[model samples]
Target chain A: MDVLTDEALDLAPCGYFEFTDDGNLVRCNTTLLEQLGFASEELTGRNVETLFTLANRIFYQTHFFPLLKLHGRAEEIFVTLRAKDGSDLPVLINAVRRPAESGFVNVCVAIPVRQRRKYEDEILQAKKVAQKALEENNELITAKEQLEAHRYILDHKLALFKQRNQDLIQLNRVITHDLQEPLRKIMLFVDKLRLDEGIRLSASGEQVIERITKASRLLKDLISGLREFVTFDVTENPPSSVDLNQVVAKARDLVIRETGFGAVDLKMSELPVIEGFGEQLQLLFYHLLSNSVKFRRTDLPTVRVEIRSSIVQDNQFRILKDRYHYVDFVRLVYTDEGQGFDTRYTPGLFQIRKKLDARTEGLGFGLAYCKKIVENHNGSISTESEPGKGTRFIILLPFRQSDQAFI
Target chain B: MNVEMDIIRRSNVKVWGSGSRTLLFAHGFGCDQNMWRFVTPAFENHFRIVTFDYVGCGKSDLTAYHPDRYANLNGYVQDVLEICRTLDLKNVIFVGHSVSSMIGLLASIKEPDRFERLILIGPSPCYINEPPDYVGGFERKDIEELLETMERNYIGWANFLAPVVMNRPDSPHLAEELTESFCSTDPYIAGRFARATFLSDNRRDLPFSRKPTLVMQCSEDLIAPLTVGDYLHRNLPNSRLVVLRATGHCPHLSAPDETIQVMTEYLGTPSLN
Candidate 1:
C-alpha cells in the first residue's frame, strides 16, 4: 500500500516531468505525456528537448540549461512545448535540478495559464467595444445640441417668412377694406351734387362719374373673391362622418337649378358614410358641378352628375404588427361631362388665379379651393381630363375614424 | 428649457403619409427641411419620411441658434436626437446629408435603441486636415477663400431674390420665398453657420455604433472623399459602403429621381422578414 505508484501521480492536475543528467526524459506522468500528445510509456526515455520546438531546444540548451545548472532551480518561465502532433502548447513550467541519485538529473512541472487571465482578456475586448460606443454617443449628443440651436434660428426665419407673406396679402385686403368706406362717401357726395339744384353738370361729366362708380364696384368684387380664396380654414379641423347623397342633392339645387341649365340628369348612388369634413366635401362637389354648369353651351346646356365607388386607391389595407398599426382605405369616383382642358394644363389646374382659358369670366379660384377643401378632409383628389371631352375626378380617403386614427 | 414649446414648433412635420418604415431626415448647414423634398414624394406611399432642418438653416426658429453653444456641428446633432425622443421615434432609419450624415453617426452611437440603421449621403468626419496617406482634397485656406466669396457675392443675391421667388399666393409659410433671395439672411449668422458646418471631428463616434449601417457615398464627391467612406467601413463592425452612380455633393438636389430610386429601394427592403 505504501509503494510509489506512478499511476496515482499521473492522474494529478499538474504535469510531472523527469529528465536524466544528459537532458533525456527518464519518465513523465500521464498529465505531462498527455499534454505532449504522447503515452507515458513512450516518453520514458526520450530526449527532453523533443517535447520542445527546435528554436525552443536551442534556447533550452544555451540559456535554460545554464540557469538550471547555476542555481539548480527555475520557476514560472513562460514557454511553448511541442506536442506529438507538432502543435505548440502554451504553458508556464517550473524546472529544478534534483540531487543526482543513480544518474537522475532534473524535474519539472507545467501549470496551464490560470483561468483568471483568459477571463480578463475576454472582458477587456468587450469593454473596449462598449467604451467606443460611449464615446460616440457623447459626441452625438453634443452634435444634436448644436443642431437644436440651428433649428431654433430657422424656426424664426420661417415664421418671418409666413408673417411676411401674410403681411403682403393682408396689405392688399386692408387697402381694399378701407377703400370701401371712402368709395361710399364719394358716391354719397356725387348723389348729393346730382340732386342739388344749386349745381348744374354736363351729361359727359355725369357719365364719367357713373363709370368711375361702376369700376369701383367691380374692383370690390374681385378683391372679395381673392380674399375668400386666401382665407382658408387650414389650422384646426376634425374628421366626421358625412352622407354623400345629401351633399350631392344640395350641390345640384344650387349649381344647376340657379344657373337655369336644362333638366339636370342627377344620378344619386347609395354612397358610403365616410369619415371627413361634410361641408368640405360638399364645397368640393359644389365647385366641380358649378364649374361644369358655368362652362357649357349657353343656348342648350345639359348637366349630368354620376357618383360611384372607386376600386383604385392610393393605399391598400395593410396589416402590420411589429412595425406599424394597420391602415384602411375607401375610394370614391366622380365623373362629369363638363369641358376639361389639355393635360399640360393639369399642373396649373389647382392654382388660384390661373385662368385656363380667356373665355371664362370668373376668377380661377373655383378648382383651386376645391383642392384645398378635399385636402382638409384627409382625402386626395386628382382629375383626368381632355380639352373637348369631359373630366373624371377620383378621390381617395379613409372610410372610418378608427382607421384614420392609426395614421 | 422650453421642451413643450419645442414640440409645438415641429408640428408642421408631414401628417398624410402612409409608409410602413419611418426615416428621419436631417439636412446640412445652409439648407432647410425642404432639402429632402426632392426624394420625399417618391417614397410617400411606401415609407414614412420625416424631414426637418437644424434651427438656423430651415423652417426652425432662428432665435434658437446660439452661436456659443452651436459653434460646432455637435450641437446640431442634439436637435436630431430631441426630434427622435419627442416623437417617440424608435428603430428609425436616419438619413443624413452632408454635415448631418456625420451628425447621424454621432447620435446613433449614443442611442442605438432609437436608430436601426444609418444612411450617410455625403459625410466627412474630418474637414480641415489631410491625414497621412489620405486625400481630404481641400485645405483650410481654401474654405476661407470660399467663405470670402459667400460674403462678397452670395449675400446680396439672396436678399434681392427672396421676395419675388417666394411670393406663392397659397404658400402657408411664406418666408421660404426669401430663402433664395439676396442675402436677406444675416451675414454674421450665415458666416458662423458656414464655419460650424465645414469644421468638425466625428471619427471617434464611428467604432461605437452597433446598429447596421449603410454609407451611400456619392462618387466624385468634392466635399467628402472616398477615403472617409473606407475609414468608416474599416471601423464599424457591420457596415457597407456603397458608391452611388451619380456625382456631386447634394444628390438629393442635383439628381433627385435617381437619388430617390436608390433611397426608396433601401428604405423599402426590410431587414427582418
Candidate 2:
C-alpha cells in the first residue's frame, strides 16, 4: 500500500485537513497547519464550526457537507474562517471522499482567496462608481426632458460606451491606486498598449477612449470607494455607549433634504461605549436610522426609532477578555421597528453579501455593508425579523466600561 | 372662503359731479363695480351714481365664497349693508337690476338707512314654482336644468358665458373692450352666483322692507316677470310699483333713457314740492 509521507504532504501547495462528520478536526499536514497558522497539536480534535463564525457553520452544514455526503465531494466552496484572534479569513474549500474506518466523509482542501477577492472586489467597486457617476451625470443633464426622441437614442448609445469605459477605467485605476501589490497586473498591460508598442487588437481599438476612460473611471471609483469605504468602515460597529437619541437627530438631519419625516419618536436607554469602532458604530446606527427615514412606510409615514439597550454583560469582552484584559463589554440589545423584511432572509443578517429588502431603490448594500463594517470592527451583527412587525438588528460587542457609555 | 364685500357706494357715487342729485347705479350679476360706465356718465354732470357687483359675480377676489356658509338671500342682503356700512353712504337712491333689486329689498329690510328710495328693476322673489300661491318666474325643474347646464359645462362659464355676461359684441359694454374681461372670478363663484340668483326664495323679504320701493317691471323679463313686480308691491309696505316702458330684464341696458327718467324722478327730488 502506497501512502504520502509526512514530508511529501508538508510540501503540497494546497491545504489539507481531515475532520469527522461532526466537524471535529482529526488531523492536518504542516501545509494545512501553516495555512491555518497553527501547529498539529493545537488543531487536532477541535470542532471545525467553532473555528468558523456561526454563519460559516450554517454554510458548511447547508451546502459544503451535504454535497460531500451525496457526491462524496464538493468543489471550490467559498467560506470565511475565524482567524486565531477572531478575524475573518475568506477561503475556497474543496473536499474529496477518502477511505475511513469511522463515519468521516472526506479530507478537505482550503485555498486562501485573499488576493483574488481583493481584485474582484476592487473591480466591482470601481465599476459601480463609474456606473453611478454616469447615471447621475446623465440624470442631471436630462431632467424631465424625455420628450426628445433623439435624446433617448443618444442615451442608449452612451450607456454602452459608459459600460466599456467602466471596464477600462476600473482596470486603469486598480493598477494606479496600488491598494494591493497585484492590482497592477490588470492596468500595466492596458497602459503598455496605450503606448503604441503593441498592435491594436479589435477590442483595443476603443482602448484609446476605452482604456483612458476606463482608467479615469477606475481612479474616480477608487477615490470614491476609498472615501466611502473609509466612511462606512468607521461606522460598522454596534454602539456600546451611544447617545442614540442624538444619533437619531443627527441622521434625520442628513436625510431631511431627501425625504419628508414629519415626526420621529425615539425610545432609548443610555448606552455604554463598549469595545467598538465609534464612527462605524455611529454609521451602522445611522444607516438603520436613515433606512427607516427613506422608506416612508407610506401607510405609516411616521418612523419610530426605538432602541432597546440592555445592561447585559458584554459577551465579546467576556469571550475576549478571558485571557487578555479585565474589561467587561456592554451588549447593546437594540431593535429597529422599521420596514420589516421577509422572514426567510433572517439567515442572511450577518452575511457579508446578503441583501433581502428591495422595498426602496437602495444600493442593497446598506445592511451588507453594515455587516462588513461591523465585522471589521470585531463586533457580531444579527437580526430577527418578520414580514410586517418590522426588522431589528442585534449587535453584540465589547463596550467601553463606563456609566457614561449610554446617554 | 366665502366673504361679504362691503360695497362702498363711492361717497360721491361720483368722484367729480356737476349735478343736483346723486345717480346711484348698481350693476347686475356677472359684473364688477365698473358696469356703470354708460348710464352713470349720462348722469355724471347731472347727478352722482353708484354701482357694484355682489361678491362672486365680478372682479372681486373669488376666494371670498364660502359655499356651506353663504347659501341664502340674507347673505346677499347683509353684503349690501356691509357695503353701505363700509362706504358710510346715505340718501342712496338705490337702483338694483334683476336679482340685485330683491337683494336691495333684503338689505333695506334689515337696514333702511342706506336707501332713501329703492328702484327695483325686474325683481323676482321666489324663483321656483309654488302650487299657484307663489308667482315664481321659473319652475323648480327649469331652475335645476339651468344649474345642470352650468355644472355640466363649467368651463363654458369662463369662456363663452363669462364673455357674454361681461361685455360681448352682442351685449352692452362693447364700448369697454377690455381683455381681462375674459379672465374673471373663479368658475366656482360663478356657479354659486347662479344658485344665489335662481335658487333662493325672497318672497317674505319684501314686506319686511319698509322703504319706498320703485318697481321697474319689464315686459320681456326672463328672470323677473312683470307679475313678480306686482307680487312684490302687494307684499311691500311703501313701494311704488311702475311697469317700465322697456323689454328685457335689464331696463338700464335695453331702455336706458326710460330707466334714467324713472330713477331721476324718484331719487333726484325725493318730493319735488
Candidate 3:
C-alpha cells in the first residue's frame, strides 16, 4: 500500500500550497483554498505572496525566501495569513524546496496559532501595567525623602539660634548685676558729701558735687534701661494668650507713675486678645506709652491709644510671612501731640543708643527695646512723626507665632 | 586569528574539478552552490572549480550571520575574498549569479591581483526602477509583491513539515533525496539576505571594474531584465555583454547548456592577449 495518496495530499487537515521558485502558485490543496475562503481556480497562477499581510510579506521576501533558496527547506516560522474578507489568521509555516524541469518548486503548509497569540498579548499588557505602577511608587518615595531632609536642616538652624540667644542672656545678666554694685556705691558717697560735710564745703565744691550727683543719676537710669533691653529674648518666655487691653492699662499706669499725669492727657480704647510672650508684650506697650509722655509739647499735650482687630495676610507687611494666606491680628495706633524730631533721624530712632534730643535726661534704648519686643511676638512696630506737630506709632501683631503657618 | 579556518567554517567552502587555473563560483540570494550543479560538470575536465555558500546560506554556519556585516554588499564580497585568500588562489575566474555577481565584481576590484576575469549571470546593479535613467525590470511595489509571494510559500512549507502525519507523495523522474534537497533555508537568515540583495544599489560600483568581465543576461528574466545587463556593460571599462536566449533569473538552473557554452567561450580566451 502507498503511504502518500493523492487524496491525502489534497485533503490534509492543514492548509498546503506549492509554488515555483519565482513565487507563482502552481498548486494548492482544497484544505488551503477553503481555509482562505477562495475557490481552487481563483488562486492558481497568482503570486503566493498575496496570501499574507504586507509586513509579513516583506518578512517572507527578506528572510524566508533567502533561507529556502539556500537550505532547500524552512521549518516552523511564525506568520500571519490574510483571509478573503481581509481579517488576519495567525499561523506557523513549514516549507520544502524541490527542483523542477524549468526552475525550483516550493511546497508549503500553514497551521493556525491564533489562540496562542491572543494569550501572549494579554501577558505583555499585564507586564506593562505593573512596570508603570512601580515607577510611580519610586517617585513618591523620592518626594518624601526630600521633604524630610528639608525639615532636618530647618531644625538645625533653629537649634543654633536658641543657643546663641541663651549665651547673650547669660552675659547680659552678669554685666547688669556687676556694674550696678559700683553705681550704687557712687551714689551713696555723693549723698554723704552733700548731707554730712555740707557746712565745711566751699561754694565751687558744692557746685561740683551737684554736677557729680546729676551725672551719677543719669548713668543709673541708662544702665537699668540697658538691662531691660538685653533681657528681652522671647525664647526665654513661653507663649500664651494675653489681652492687649490689660497690657495697655498696666503700661499706662507705669508711665503715669514716673511722669505725673498732671499735664499729659492719655486715652485708651478696647483691644483684642492675641497669642504672644506676655511679659515682652507688656514691656513693648510700656516703652511706647512712656515715649509719648516724655516727648509731649508741654503746652497742650494730647495722647490717644487706639487698638483694633482684623484678619490680615502677613504679606501686607515687609517682614512677616504671607505663607498662611490670612491670620488674625491686633493693631495698636498710638498718636501723641509731642515735640517730634526731624525725619532724618527716623531710621536710626529704633536703634540702640540713638538719641533724638541730647538735652532730655533719658536713655535712648526705649524705642529700640519696643521694636525688639514687637519682633519677638512675630509682629511689627513703626512710627510716623512730624518735627513739631505729633508722633503716631503703629503696631501690628499676628495672633500666632509658629513659622510653619507660612509654608 | 586563523582567517582560513574562519572562512572555511563560515562559508562551507567546497572545491571540485581539476586544472591549473581556478574557477570560483558564488551563489545568488535565493539558492546556494547547488544552483551550479548542472553547469559546473561541463567545465570540471578543463578547469579547477571552487564553490561555496554565502554567509547565511546553505551548509555555512548560520551563527556568522551578523545583520550589520551582511547589511551591505561589501560583507558578501569579504566572504569571497576570504575564500580566495584561504585557498591561496590567484588568476581566479570568478562566476557569480544574481546579487552574487555584484559581490564578485566588488571582490575583484578590492584584490585585482587574485581574479583574472568575472562572469556575472543574470546580474542587475539595481532591482527597482529609477525612472528617468534606469529601469532594472521590477518596480519597488512589484518586488514587494514578489517578496509576499515568497513568504506565503515559506509559511505553507512550514505547516506541511510540522508534526502532523501525512502520506509521502512521489513525482515522476524526481528521486526522494533529490526532491528533498530543494529550497532548504533558515527562514530568519533568508529574509535578511533577500532584503540585502533586492534593496541594494550597486550601480556606482560598476564603473570601477578593472578585470575583463562577462555579463550573462537572460532573454526573459523578470528579476534582471535586458536593460540592466546593458547598463552594466556600458559602465564597466573592460567588459563584454552576451544575452542568453534562456528564460528566468537562474539560467544555470533552467538553461544550463547555454550558460556553460557562453561562459566557456569567454573564459577560454587568454587574458594576457
Share of native interface contacts recovered by each model: 0.00, 0.00, 0.04
Query: Cα deviation of A193 in candidate 3 (Å)?
Result: 99
Instruction: In model 3, state the lDDT of residue B165.
Output: 27
DockQ of each: 0.02, 0.00, 0.02
Which of the two candidates, 1 or 3, achieves a greater TM-score against the reference?
3
For residues B1-273, what per-residue lDDT tens digits would candidate 1 score against the true structure? 587557437423443367667888877655556556557777778677787666665456666665654566555666777788887888888888877887787777545568888887877777666567555556676567445433432323332223333332223354363333221145456667667766666665566566777777777555666877787688776777888766546667546777777776776566541
B1-273 per-residue lDDT for model 3 (tens digits): 586788887898888888998889988876778677778889899789899988777678877776556766766877888899899999899999888898898777656679998889988889878889889765667566555445444444544233322222332332333443343366556666777778888786676577989999977665777878888889988889999877566778656788899988887777841
**Rank order (by lDDT, best first):** 3, 1, 2
Comparing 1 and 3 on lDDT, the stronger one: 3
lDDT of 3 by residue, A243-288 (tens): 8888877878888888786444556655778888777788787887
Label model 1 with its docking quality class: incorrect
TM-score of chain B of each: 0.85, 0.81, 0.89
What TM value does model 1 have?
0.38
- Whole-model lDDT for model 3 versus the true structure? 0.73
Go through the candidates in order and give each one's C-alpha lDDT. Answer: 0.64, 0.57, 0.73
